[model samples]
Target: MTNETKIPNTRWWRILPATVLVYIVANIDRANISFAMAGGMMEDLGLDAVAIGMAIGIFFWGYLLLQVPGGHLAERKSAKHFIAAMIVIWGGCATICGFISTSFEFNVVRFILGIAEGGIFPAILVIISHWFPPAERARANSIFLLSFPLSAIISGPISGWLIATWGWREMFIIEGVASIALIFLWMPLIADRPSKAKWLSAEERNWIESELAAEAAAKKAAAATNKSATKTSYRELVFDINLWKMVAVYFLICCAFYVLSFWLPTIIKDILKADIGMVGWLSALPNIAAALGIVFFGRMADKSQNRRKYCIIPYVCVGLCIIASVFTASYSGWLSFAFLCLCGFFWLSGHPVLWTIVAETFQPEVAGGARGAINALGNLSGFFAPMLLGYMIQNYSRDAGMYIFAVLVFLAAVIVWSMPKNAETKAAVEKTREHVAATTNAHA
Candidate 1:
């Protein structure tokens, strides 16, 4: 604003694609298990629904081990190096999944894979925080999160075809090797922050640095007025009521999300009475809707001050759609599929807003650890959701587990609604708005 040229958004072009690609590969490795289950891994390994669920759920246990430490390392050390090492290690574990003969062996490899992949999410979030300022963060998060649905869209048919043509073993080998190869691409493209990026012009770097510094100052100012504004340590953060509220919300959200992610292939196959290949193609539809919803709702949240409303609305809609899909499945497969697409749209779209809330709530110093703790605790539901759903599907009707998913998502919305307003985030947003306005005036 002080006679400097307007900073270009060079970070988005340089940073987003690399992050998106890394997540896509990571998700493909994570989610391809669903395809493996549907495409005969269960029968080959002599696993029932319960046994497979346990194997799938066990991954989350290992996932919890590294999250906090990974986040701390990324914040204190280097995200680029941390993520690169994880990619190589996880890729090796994923490849080992194809070679396992016993259920114990499968579970072991999956646990190792989970440990390898645990830190990647929080590390990437830290990286995003370093480069994008508060005002642009929601949209940046949404774009990065596109990898979730986009991975499903790509992996669905591709995984199905791979299994059909070769075998589930080969599918695992192929995807794992592909994830390993991506390390080369990720290493060269990513920088820890704008300051470290050689490709960034001095003006852009200065703009980013100044904007981030102003937000940090705003947070410190807010902390002076609000007793609970800043948390200094993990022990203090654990006892914080606001942190627990967010963890509860995220835990419920993950319950619904993982249920759909892990079970959708089998659900689709059941609905249409179709083969695995057709199920793969059909599974892509819901994710296409999810992709569109993320872009639209992410922009909408960025434009509005009441981002909480955006989060609440989508969660409520997701709950309703899940119930509707269950009811419609008996009458019409296509109708049921339509409702599932709606569920995907709403559930996935709300994620960026939720993360934006977390990013805004914490200071830069504790942001990494706070995010890691929330993510680790929230993801514990990933373990229980699948196992519970599998037990329900095995014992009762398929729709039985879905009813619980609907209720869980509804509860998530209620938690979001009840959470107290975040004073620190509000102050930061106000400061960001003032900074933007001043910059505009300076340009004029």
Candidate 2:
């Protein structure tokens, strides 16, 4: 491995805390609601399963609307300021939840909170694409995203304890305060571009910048053979069949992951018939497994540089586990839990793999826009998945919801299987040249 690809660099040390720790705090803000639901937010608001689902999912609606704008904005200008502003807004919205008594009030703030958070991940992707070369990016994306499971590992029990002792309202208000405080850490530590990261040694900075420049040059060279590529607008990311294929797969992945994220505690509690606090700790096991998977799969992807295989494996695992969990839960609750833990383990791998494919496909200049487009579209699953599960649980059975999840994962696997490989991406670009030639001749 080259020096630049090594993980012992100053950049990982600097960027990991900004992305991972702050995201840990952000996850706390978003996820505390699950604890709150368990803590009696549902009873207080008189919300049924469907209402809970919509409340959980509506945030994505607002989140979805601004993703393109938020992503493109970060690409055009400064992610540092854009992310800072979003944290503050989401923090405020989380705080508002503590005071909200009505369902309307609750959903409204959650929706606004979604709008605030919509850009942050896309902006971070922009930042990563700039600072880390592709060789290190899967590792970077893995370690950075490892924070999601880490958040669950840490937040699950803490939220449970808080809800059990104090109440759900206090949990929201306190976590919101924590979210606001993290922005202070974010602003000082995060630099939008490598040149601004003065903490790095001069040599380190030069290496990162030069490596990224070389990758950009390579992309341009690959595109130059495609006559239409010269005229290819960044807007073309929207229409790229390959890009959309990735997005659809990610959507299914989100559906499975979020079901566990938003609903696992509730499901586990039904199986165990135990204390909420115990459920908190029990629910944490899957997240711990997921955290390990994120790092392990990310590093493996970086080392192997076999992006599509890694992506496909996780969805297949998730689908199998979804089917297995139905049988396991019928016999043993612990067996069902073990299946979910495995599901979480493989489920977390797809994300880092997906982002690595994107980083390898698009340049940093438009990388945020591409990430935003994919996430905006992909993340719509976050909205529908929860709502559908909620509907299924209320009308049919939780097993019925699992069936839907399995179906989604099956479709996701199909899409990932069809996605073009790296060499094929080049071929796809070359095909655009042929299309341009044929059109030119016809018009002439």
Q: Against the true structure, whose lDDT is highest? A: 1
Tell me how candidate 1 scores on lDDT: 0.88
Runs of candidate 1 with Cα error greater than 4 angstroms are: 2-6, 224-226, 422-424, 427-429, 432-444
lDDT of 1 by residue, 289-336 (tens): 989999888999887846788899999999999999999999999899
Instruction: Evaluate all candidate structures by whole-model CA lDDT and list the values in order.
Output: 0.88, 0.81
Best by TM-score: 1
Question: For candidate 1, what's the RMSD?
Answer: 2.3
Compared with the true structure, what per-residue lDDT tens digits does model 2 show for residues 1-444?
124444348887888778888778877787778888888999999999999989999888988977878888888888899989888888999988999989999999999999888888888888888787766789889988988999998988899998888999998988888888877799889998888877878778766765665566556766644322232457666567766787888888898888879988898888778689998998888889898888888888877777888888888888998788777888998888888888889878879989988877765566677789888988888799999988888889989889889889988888888866666434443454445446556876
TM-score of 1: 0.95
After best superposition, candidate 2 residue 226: deviation in angstroms?
Answer: 8.2
* RMSD over all Cα atoms, model 2: 6.6
For model 1 the local lDDT of residue 30 reads 91
